[model samples]
Target: MTQSPAIPLPPPAERRRLREAQSLTQAQVAERVGVGRDTVRAWEAGRTTPRGRKAQTYASLLAAASATAHEVTLRQADPTAPLTPLTPAQAFDALYAFCAPALVRQAYLLTGRRELARESVERAFQLAWHRWPEVAVDPDPAGWVRATVYECALSPWHRFRARHRHPEAPPADPADRALLAVLLRLPPPYRRTLLLYDGVGLGLPETAAETEASTPATANRLLHAREAVAARLPDLADPALLSRRLAEVAAHERLRAARPPVVRAGSERRARNWTHAAIAFTVALIGATTFTLHTAPTQYNPPVAPGATVQGVPPRAAPGALSRAELDLRTKLQRAATNGPERLTPDAR
Candidate 1:
């Protein structure tokens, strides 16, 4: 019988919990995941993202084992409550209700396109539904959904598609348009930092954690972001005033401010249909656009070492081709090689 591969590692914070739930040591996990123990340690410690097929298997194994243990614990804790697995429908409904509105607003703020924001948020929620088992148990499920939305908003294919569509609501006045234009003109990192900080009202540490930067580095980015915005739009220089203005702009521009409707219980087919539709649309778009996705590999060759020649390639000796310095160096090396034994004499030396 073929043994199934281990599941991929979950988020760094939850790795330990998942491991402990299965009563597995790091060594056991490493062996199962087909990685070194130190690799498992690095994953649990948040030093790196678990890469490759083993990562997916490791996460699957942990989530499956964790679900079983979780249900057992729940049953022990409460006799009346059923020990049912969390279904896709329930997870989708819960995450959508909790996160949809805020994520819509964040997407709008990021993209400056209202309809695009709605679509991005829904698409992210749909994806969350498909992977609910893994995502539902994440330490910050809402954050996970939000990150997915952010990815959708920033995707190049989506951006290209969005260029032809008009925004649902254009700015009513020139000032609003100017402010938004300047805000969007900032670099992506600075813009995201500003939105997470000023627009979403996340504190320094939370924003830092979300952006995967240290607190000090997040602060520096925020400061520079403020300075850049202030330099361009002098009225926005004041931190408090900027935050208030951002809130007001977002309020005015948000297409949907209401929470998503509850997905009925046992509507797994409905949820799957929604997710499948999104996937189909994305596929169609890719086909229509002839989009080619490029992935960077984990390893690449460095440039040729200094002073090393390619094998079988003779030095350039043509008069015009050789620079004076190059010619001098080559001539000196050739002379030294030719004169080696004879030049070893004391007088020659």
Candidate 2:
């Protein structure tokens, strides 16, 4: 007589928890764990268990999933919660919130002064906000803000002041001077792109969007900026060294704003109110239109094809066949119908 074969056990509850945390489907988890889809499902469903090396794989995958989940949860809790995974509108808001401080730091690094840098950055943020509808639609909101800030700093008015005025204050600190030397070595566009992309860790598409340029153009700007900076400050070319320097600067300056409060409860209430208002308004408008159409005289003109005779009159011209004068008149009438008398031009009257 032969003994029964040992049965494989299902993955433990911790494994299922890990997979759930990572947002991975059973198939995805199965693929990562090098198990069949059904096996993953079984493990997750507690139908069967993983054994030996398979169990080890499950444990490793679970650990990775847990780590990923933790990061996502932290990101969502960030006061700048709406920005982490950006929609176009959220990108606009993030740009507005962060642009000033980032630009101020960049300007300070370049000009070796805080006051002028802050002014430049503030003005840039104001201008960017004014153009947010257009600029926010761009792929790189941050890059746009950075470019705008640099432009403001280098505008004719600023240049005039720089050229004519004598330094009223003491010379910049030695470190600031060194940083300025490195920054000045970069051309305007390249410097802005590099600082916004590398320094700020914005992606290529984002940088392009912000700069209002093609991705290739942004890439070129970044490349040239890096090269220019590297040539001047060779020490920054080393990844570890650059990271260390940036860490030091970040620690000293603390440029990015603290996370703002998440507007959860109010947002939900406002959304509900708007939805109800919209539904009620729609119902009222429909009811009013129905009453009007019901009460009004109904003309029983038969539908006529263009160029066809109807009753005693020639058929009305097709939309495209109307003369320019007729089209203009129709457009004016349409504007009047939709927008009421206030929108009508004097000429329309």
Candidate 3:
């Protein structure tokens, strides 16, 4: 057998320059660039350089890291003290404060009515705040919150049950309202997938992880969501509305991204405990219903007891004469009949 020729590598100086420009340790650079530590070492030692897509990825990482490092340095040099880390409650409050405007914008885009959006965002944030710890730890906390807000915005439950639910038709903002209308019409899975991908800017893998779906499933959901949205666009009065709405949505995202970190308070802790109690109560109710359904005895009326006529008079058997097997068979037959004819075999006749 013949051995293949060895591949030539990049010079050591080039690799060192890239690393220095990014202001990253070899390991840090490797992680950000999605390369192994050994690959970094090889590049630095003039042993090898990544080729094709890998090389492009490395270049992108170098550029991004350089930009991020500059930003961090600038922030640190400011005279203001760094923001304190928030307690869970404080975090929830901060989240609420941030979500209020954000949700309104999202809702407005979705429903074309500021009032409806405002109500939806408020309710969503309140519920989210109660479960902040779980939501905050999510990979994309903002996206998770936004998804919840969307659900609240279009919830049929509230529309049906709440007397105070928005009764008047939502005022339409041509651009956003169109998108919202399209999104609302989509199936839940498709809607969620679209929001995660386009609205939240998550890639397929990230969306799959967040939704607990396979990559293909997430991709299909996104595709279907877009199709659904596109099919309804003609119904929108203004064709130019989508572009205007997108710009507004982008602005909103930037504003939220720029907010300062917040700290938590004692009262927030108590509220969280109350939220937990509510969740426990709901679970308990569901469990009780399930138990009742499982354990309750089924009632079946047996066919009228057969009577023997002796000299044109009806006669009854002695009282309490049914055998266990007879009682069981009778119940089985009743059940079989109630279920369907398919349950009865030819031999059952």
Candidate maximizing TM-score? 1
Whole-model lDDT per candidate? 0.68, 0.57, 0.56
State each candidate's clash count: 13, 10, 1
* Tens-digit lDDT track of model 1 for 183-216: 7787777888887777655678877887888999
Provide the global lDDT of candidate 3 against the true structure: 0.56
Off by over 4 Å in 1: 1-91, 162-169, 257-349
Residue 181 miss distance in model 3 (angstroms): 3.4
Worst 10 residues of 1 by lDDT: 1-10
| Model number with the top lDDT | 1
What TM-score goes with each of the models?
A: 0.49, 0.38, 0.42
C-alpha RMSD by candidate, in order:
23.8, 25.0, 21.0
Query: What are the runs in model 2 whose C-alpha is more than 4 Å off?
Result: 1-99, 128-147, 162-176, 243-349
The residue-by-residue lDDT of candidate 2 on 1-349, one tens digit each, is 1100111111356557767777788888778778889998777766554543454456446544544555576686885765344443344344444344445666655454456666666655555555657775664455465666667765556656754265433233555345556765677667566655555445677667666789999988877776665687787776334434532443355344322122223334556787999999999999999999899977878788678445887666776677889889999999878876556357754
Off by over 4 Å in 3: 1-90, 108-116, 132-140, 162-178, 232-244, 247-349
